[model samples]
Each structure stands twice: as C-alpha cells, then as structure tokens.
Target: MDSETTIREPRAADGGLDLSPVSRGRTPLLLRFTLFAIFFFPATMVIEPLGASGTVPTLLCLVLLLAWLASWLWGLHDPIPVRHPGRLAISLLLLASIASYAALYAGWTGGSTEMTRASADRWLLLLAASAALVLVTAEVIRTMADALQLVRALLAGAFFCCLVGVAQFVFRVNPMEWIQAAMPGFTYNGGDTPFQIRGSLMRVAGSTFHSIELGVVAAMLIPLSIWRSLTDPRGRRWFHWAQTALLVFAVTTTVSRSGILGLVVALLVFVPFLPRLVRRGLLLSAPFVVAGVFLIVPGFVGTIASALGADTSDPSIATRVNNYPRVVQLLDSHPILGSGPGNYTPPDALRILDNQYLGSLVTLGIVGLLATLAYFLLPGIAGVLAARAAVHPALRGLAGAVAAGALVAAVCSMTFDSLSFPVFALLYPALVGLAGGVWRMVRREADLRDDENAATARGAMMARAPAPTAKEVG
Candidate 1:
C-alpha cells in the first residue's frame, strides 16, 4: 500500500500496534517525566558529599544517566547540537587540563601517590558526569514539552522535603519513620552540625546533607513559584500561592544567609515581569507573600546571624581567606597550565578555597577555569535571549525568570561552594538544554517568518501583473 493509504488504515485494530495500555490511564510522557523529577531531585540535596560505602545515590545517578542514553538510542527523541561557542572553548580547556596534569605528574616531587589517585578519581567522576550532561541535554530537547512538568515536579519535591524538615523541627522528633519504611535500614549518612540561633525554634535539616543545602533548595523554588503564579491561570493561582508560602517557610527555617540572598535576588529579578501578567495575580499573591514573611523570616535571620558571628576561634572562613595568597603564589609560578589537574595541594594545602573559579584555576589552570566559566555563562546568556524571543508570552515570562534565577544562583553559590554539589551539577546541564530548546524554537519562528514574507511578496507581484490576452496566448 502507498504510505498515505497505510496511514489511513486502523493499524492498531489490525493488531499492528498495542493501544490498550495507552487507552488505559497510563501516565503520559510529560507526566512520567515530571514524576521522575519529583521523586529524584529532592534526594540530590541529601546525597553525602563524603562518599557512602553503599550505592543508593550513585546507583540512582547511573540509572538517570542510562535513562537519558536510552531515550536517544530508542529513537524517542533527538536534541539539536547546542549553539553556544563555549562548548568548543570548554573542550579545549579540558585538553589544557590534561596537559597540565601530565606536566604535574612529570615534575611535581611534592605530590603523594595516594593523594594523586584520589584527585584522579574525582576527575574521572567529573568526566563521567559531563558525559551524562550531554545525555541530559539530548533528553531535554527531545522532551521540551515535558520541561515545565519536570520543573513543577522539582518545586513540589523541594517543598515536600522542606515540609518534612519543618515538621521535624516543630515536633522535635527524627522524622525518619517514613524514610525507614521506604528504605528499610537506610541510615542518614551525613554528619549533622545543627545551626544554633537565639530563637528556640529547632532548625530542621530534613534528609538533606546539610541545613544550608536545604536552604538553597528552598531558595531555588521561589522563582519558579512566582513565575507560575504570575503566568498560570486563576484556578491554578492557589497552588502556586501555597507552594510559594511553603518554600519561603522552608528557606527561613534552614537559616542560610546565602539562601536568603538567593531568594531576594530571585524576587527582585521576577518583580519587573509581574506587572506584565494579569494584575489580579500580582495583587492577589502579594498579601500571601507578605504574610509568609511574618511567619517565616525571624528564625532564618537569627540562624544566619549566629553562624556569621559564632566564632573567630573557628577559623574556617578566615583560613579560606588567608590561604588564598599561597594559592595565588602557585598560580603565578605555573600560570599557563597551573600545578596540574588535581595537583594543587602544595606542602601547605590549608583550605579548599570556597570559590569555584579559584578551585578551577588551581587544578584545571587558566584554561579549565575559562572552560568552566563558558559552560556556565553561555547557558545563562542563551536563556535570556531565548526568553526575549519566545513566541508564547507565558513561556517567555517563565524562561526569563528561570534564566534570572539560575544566574543569581551561579553568582551567589560561587562565594560559598563549588558545582560539585548534586543539585548544582544537575541544574547546569538542565538549564543548558532548556536554553537550547528555546533557541531552537526561536530559530524555527524566524525561518517561518522569512518563508511567510517571501510568499506574501510573490503574491503581491502576481496581483500587480496584467491578465494574459489572446495575443499573449498565441
């Protein structure tokens, strides 16, 4: 049969394709993806930075990576190549890192074999994660419609985790009963250094490795809620409102100053777009937002203040500052490639600099640092431009806020930590894919516009031409 005829036939009725499962209430692709995001993302914050002997989190990462790969191999979806110039730039940076590592291994007499081995392992893990990032980019592009679903899922999951933490704090109990029921004998692996604020309220860490990590998670969700509230329908307004309030409560309870700053940045960046949405949304949500502040802010503020003022005796912050000069001295000695990839611990490697750029420079050298910066900055720029060019008004608004929020997170987090954190690592590639999809849509629209203009111009010319006469026909 001809292709058209074959398509017209009821192939599923002919037993060519199974439709029963689809006809039943099986989850749609978007919803399945959303559920996956919801289940998996919150747990990322809880993954032990100090490696667990067991493989739950590692195994989960592997599974996610495989799922991303399977999506591509099964012909379910294909992602366009990212258009950022930084991709090439960063690859070159990795090459430079390899070169630096070679030099360090050859020349650095100070390096210990065991220490070198550990650094090498970390580097290998980083490369493996980078490969997974490529898969995530492909999967996201393949399933752009599912992107918002995944984002909403993340928001819901973060809120739920926060709620659990809050409940633990209020009741002064280990809320690990549900956890134990879910994964019998699953010990909470990480150390707990609880934040002590003047207020007697117990700060809850939930399942996250640290209360600070939990705070960051809450901060990240606020922008998404604000975006949805402003752009989603009135019936959905309450959902966003409730979500925002919950997230704010979570952030306040965690009491990370960095988290507070991140939230403020998200809000300020989003407020300009609020007026563009239905006025009722902004007005309706405003009172709830204010009320949440009264309910949430004091505890968070006090906790943050205590952490900052706690002690000159504990020189973690001071040591980080003091150690920078020696790091800079090493950088000056080996400026081009630096000591090597994972070869930065000199005789006096005092503190792991709480700065991504500095840490990158020490290992990857100038080249790796440049590459890392490109990887981050390129996505943010693409996101902003794509949001500006989006055809759908709601998506444009949302993309803009997401872009802003990610940008703020990048800048703020760099002061306190590196991208080695699970959430940050996942978000970097995910945002890249989002920007890539929006850019693809933008280009498609431009192409369509050009074609439309050409057609219109041709029609105008035809209309202006005289009708053919009998002489012309002869």
Candidate 2:
C-alpha cells in the first residue's frame, strides 16, 4: 500500500500530525481495532469467567496492547509517537503502584502478610496495558475529523450500554444472562446483590457491574453526546441529541450519588466552554429536562433527592466515615508509600474503601495519591486550555468534551473506589490517551503554521533583496 494515498486530505495547518501515518478518510487498522474495542468493552464488563474476576474486555485490552506493540515495531503506521502527555501521566501512576508493591514485599509497609504476588502483579499489568492504550490512541488521531468520528463511535458504545439499562428499567429483563449460555463458566461480575432499589424504583446497572458504575459512565458520556449533537449536521443533530437525552435518562434511573456527582461535574466543565446561545439554551432547558425525567420515572427524582439529603443516617455515609480511623492507622504505619494497591482482600485483608482518594492514601500512600490526582486532572486541564485556543469548531468541541469527561472521572473518584471497577477504570484512561493524541495533533498543526510563516518571511526577504553589482563577478 502506498503511504502517499490521502483519503480526506487535511489542511496544511491543522489535520494530520507529521508522525501519524493515518490519512483523513482512512481509519488505521489499529484504530479500527481500537474503535471496536471501545464499542464492545462496555457490554462485556458484566461477565466474569469461571467464577473469577475476568471479562472479554480484559482480554481485549491485552490484545490492544499487543497490537500497539506490533504497530510500533513493524512501522506500519507512525514509527514513533510525536507527543506523550497521556503516557507521562499514566506512567507516573503505574510507577506509583510499582513502588507501593515493592514497599509491601520489602516489609516496609503494613498491608497483610497474606497478600500474594499474583494479585499485585495483576494490578501492575492492568496499569501498564491501560498506559499503552493511551499511548497508541494519542498516536493515531490525526485531525478534527478523526476526533469527531471517534466521538460518534464512543456515543454509539454509550448507547449500547444505556439501552441495556433501559431494558432492565422498562421491560424487567436482563440480556446479559444470555451471555452466560454461550460461556457456561461465566458468572455475574457485580456484588452479591444483582440489583438495588430506591423508593419504588429499581436501579439499573446497564452493562456495568453495578448501578453506580453505569451511572458514572453515563455521566461521563453525556457531555460528549451533547458536543457531538452540537457539531453534527442539522439533519443529523436530532439523532445525537436523542443520544444525549438517553444518557441523561439512564443516569437518572440509577439514583446513585456518584453518578449525579459525575453528571454535574461534566455539565459544569462542558457548559462554560460552549458558545453563548448554546450555553444559554442548555441552562434554560435543564429544569424542564429534570421535570420530564421525573414525570417519566415518577419517584426517581424524589428518591435521589432524599439520598442526597441523607446525613449520618445513611448506612453508606456512615460506613465511609467509620473507615477513617482504620485508614489513619494504616497511613501512620507507612506515611509515604502505604500498604499496597490492589492489596485489599476481604476476610483477612482490608475491605473496599468508598472514596478513591482515601483508598489511595491507605493503599498507595502519599506519593501514589499525588500520582492519582495528576493522572486524572492534568490532561483534562490541558484539554480545556487547548480547546480555548482551537480554531476549528470540531477540534474545539472535542477538546471541551474530553476535558468534561476527565473532570467527571476525577470528581466521581470522591464518591466511589472507581478504579476498582473495570469499565470505568479502562474508559477514563482511554479518555486521557485520546486527549494526549489530540494534543499532539494540535501541536503539530501549530508547528507547521510557524514553519510556513518562517518560509514566507524568507521568501519576502529574497524578493526584496537589491540587484547584485557587476563588481561581484570580478
């Protein structure tokens, strides 16, 4: 295949990054796999094989990692990545986990002695694989058009998840049970409780392990759906808008505070970046949308409201508060690089902590906690700043949505041990990876514009130069 084949040709200033071998119309084979992986990973998150913690998506992640490695070595696409904003941050996170594990084995930590090397090793491999996903994704996205396509793919994936959740809500059936038939060894991956209730309403889990996980994932995708709707053609806008509505409805069904936190954070990050009229339209419609959902699911809004209003009386709230004393003791034993990440095993080991930050402090220690914050926050802040400077409407909207999604992950961390869940864990890192890739493309364009200006200035100088004298020939 000729490398010179251009599909949708990019403008000299802002389409293809120099390192990206992907042309505008062409989806590189790796990226094709990436998109497919994104689509099905959400749906596969519910099944654990052989009564152990595993999913098809987990195997897919390993496949993605190998594909990226093959691409890097075979030079079928970009021989090297031009930028690595996501990789740097993700690598820091992985390094922190390694340090915590090393500390545990060296007897420098206070975690359980019964903790096996295999568990810690699994955690490390997952982190490394997630980082590779970020690296390869950032390497492939070449233009605003590519970004928009990626957004559509992501929205479609979200739709699949939301649809499953909707089925549970409206039809009282779960299609995930069918997967169990194909893979006889597979079992439900969520908690002992398969479902939950709020008032008279049944909480929906979608393709995720728990209702809260589905809600948080829905919250993260809503901004991207809205951004896609705004940027799509007028005829196609309604389709995307309907997706946005579905995502919102899905989140409302969960009645999970974590999901609510993520949705609010997504909107807060997204709305300010929107054009004035668009922003105003969303703000004015907010109450009506709430009213509409409340009308559709009669007791849901009241259920969520009372859940939010719960003080010390809430068992969930009380559990989180009571865990602090134990966390403090663990932190005191190993102040810098606490016990160990993924070391929390029940019965003999520590139980799950509700807050990711507090959990990180107890498990990963101070350095690890900082790495967690940096991984979740830095790329998002950078994306928002990049969006402000972006000239293309497509690029601007994509950047803003990326920022909003990342912020949702960060904010939702305070509400749950988010990293413990597979889909959210994988999706959040993938968002960071996409941000890095987009950042590299944007930087490439800026550098090209600079070069063009420099060349133009040199040409002008040559054209303006005085005629050479005959004396120079002597």
Candidate with top TM-score is 2
TM-score of 2: 0.86
Tell me which residue pairs clash in candidate 2: 8-25, 138-437
RMSD of every prediction: 7.5, 4.3
Q: What total of clashing residue pairs does each candidate reach?
A: 0, 2
lDDT, model 1, position 33: 46
lDDT by residue (6-51, candidate 1, tens digit) is 1222221233221111122221354334333432433323334433
Per-prediction TM-score: 0.74, 0.86
Tell me the whole-model lDDT of each prediction, alpha carbons only.
Answer: 0.56, 0.74
Compute the lDDT for candidate 1: 0.56
TM-score of 1: 0.74
How many angstroms is residue 403 displaced in model 2 relative to the true structure, after the best TM-score fit?
0.6
Off by over 4 Å in 1: 1-58, 64-112, 142-144, 174-203, 229-237, 271-275, 278-288, 296-320, 330-334, 338-352
